[model samples]
Target: MDFSQLKKEIIEYSKTIGIDKIGFTTASTFDELRNRLIRQQELQYQSGFEEKDIEKRVNPALLMDSPRSIIAIALAYPSKMNERVTSKKGERRGIFSRASWGEDYHLILRDRLKKLEAYIIERVPEAKCKSMVDTGELVDRAVAERAGIGWSGKNCSIITPEFGSYVYLGEMITTIPFEPDQPIEDQCGTCNKCLEACPTGALVQGGQINAQKCIAFLTQTKGFIEEQYREKIGNRVYGCDSCQTACPENKGKNFHFHEEMEPDPEIVKPLLKPMLQISNREFKEKFGPLAGSWRGKKPIQRNAIIALAHFKDETAVDELIEVMNKDSRAVIRGTAAWALGKIGGETAKAVLENARETESDEEVLVEIERGLAFFK
Candidate 1:
């Protein structure tokens, strides 16, 4: 079978299907990435969301039988929103990171991969392929790097030259022996922008990140955010974009290639106060389409409370008092207590004082005490 001709056909077909970039690499074990994963594990810097087994993450052979090559594809997302949310006094908004601006990238990338997989199978009847997006055991960034989709940036994003770091990546491991593309040279040279711009210094150094301290990671946590990082979180309700926004390479690199990736400004940057009171059905109806809502309403609600405090939004005081008094979740009630203190009006202070007497949960009680401390 003419595998070289088949590979060429796949490349041409990819363009017709809206895949922004496609590259191929031999399915050798990723030794460098394996070592880095070990180091991240040793330092306890990894986000618990990753696959725990490091071996499966680095070896394509384990994921699919006799894998001969990996086909990496990228889909560019818009960095700038077409419509703007009107921000006025008493109606402040919180921002979701650009990655979460539209439909969940995982679904979009999976659709692309399925199309590619079907196209390959049609050409070679016996072809076997395994596809994955971010959640899979295989590291998407490592595969994209080796497949020449992009160079690994200092911010730990796969930085594609055409689309900057604002690209969604996925891969398919296949039994076809496609010639590998050369990896791009790292272009971040001496640029400390991403490292310097990280809100929590999550970028330990170039090409390394402490996910525990990353605002993007922290915003997704179901528990109480650490006290030290709460102020730094600012108005980000989902992920943080400081690192990507700071990179020079990404400057003016907005792409509105796919219709599904367009942002609904009101949804992505909704009013913080409304988020606090959104019912489960309402939350699913509104934010359910975006990737940022995957952790459900608790974390986003917690962050929204924190954002109100960051803005010191006096208008949200009444709602916050209600949450502190009546919310079922201790984390939400506790975070509301903290925000009330941070906002600190006579009413906010009075609510905290009242909750101090009635709040039963030990953790919520501690947060109430901390809230009262702000008044002193």
Candidate 2:
């Protein structure tokens, strides 16, 4: 079987299917990434969303039988929204990171992978392939790096020369022996922009992050956000983009290649107050299609409350008061209490004082007290 000719065919076919970029690499164990995962585990810096078994994450052989190579594909997303949301004088809005702007990337990437796999199978009847997006055991960034799709940036994102860091990556492990592409040279030389721009200093150093402190990670957490990082979160409801936005390489690097990648400005940057009261059905109808909605409406609502406080949006005071007093979830109730304090006014202070008396949950009470402290 002419594997070299087959590989060339796959490359040309990939372009016709809207895959922005494709690269190949031998399926050798990722020794460097394995060591880094161990270090991140030791430091408790992992987001806990990653696969716990570090071995499975670094070795492609474990994921698929006799894997000979990995095929990495990138889909570029738009960095700038075509339509911008206009915030009224008293209205406040929260921004979802660029990643969560459009249809969930996992589904989009998985569809592309399936198409690639079928194309490969048509050529080589016996070829076996395993495909994965972000949730899979295999680290997508590491695979992309080895496949020469991009260099690992200081922000811990894969930065392709053509698309910068604003690209969604996925990979397929195949039994076909494809020649590996050379890894790109790291171009973030002495550029501390990403590290310096990190809101919580989550970028501990170049190409490393303390996920625990990352606003992007924190926004996904189901629990209460740590006080130190709450103010830093600002109006980000889903993920943070400070690191990527700060990188010089990503400057003016906006691509609107795929129609599905286009964002609805109103949905991505919705009014902060409406988010607090959105019903389960309404939440699903509106945000469920976006990747940011995977965590459900609670975390986004909690962050929305925090964002209202960030802007000190006096108009949201009434709604925040209702959430503090009546919300079923302690995290929401507590975060709303905290936000009420941060956006203090006579009414906000009064609601906190009332919630302090009626709030039964111990954590909620603590937040109520914390909120009241702002008035003093």
For all candidates in order, the CA lDDT equals: 0.94, 0.93
Worst ten in a row by lDDT for model 2: 85-94
Compared with the true structure, what per-residue lDDT tens digits does model 1 show for residues 1-376? 9888988899999998889999999999999999999999999999999999999999988898899999999999999999998766799899999999889999999988899999999999899999999999999999999999999999999999999999999999999999999999999898999999999999999999999999999999999998899999999999999999999999999999999999999999999999988999999999998999999999999999999999999999999999999999999999999999998988988888888888889999999998889999
Q: Which one is best on lDDT?
A: 1
Q: How close is candidate 1 to the true structure, as a TM-score?
A: 0.99
lDDT of 2 by residue, 1-376 (tens): 8888888889999999889999999999999999999999999999999999999999988888899999999999999999998876578889999999889999999999999999999988899999999999999999999899999998999999999999999999999999899999998899999999998999999988999999999999999998989999999999999999999999999999999989999999998898989999999999999999999999999999999999989888888888877889999999999998998889888878887778899999989998999989
Residue 233 alpha-carbon offset, candidate 1, angstroms: 0.7
Superposed model 2: Cα runs more than 4 Å off: none
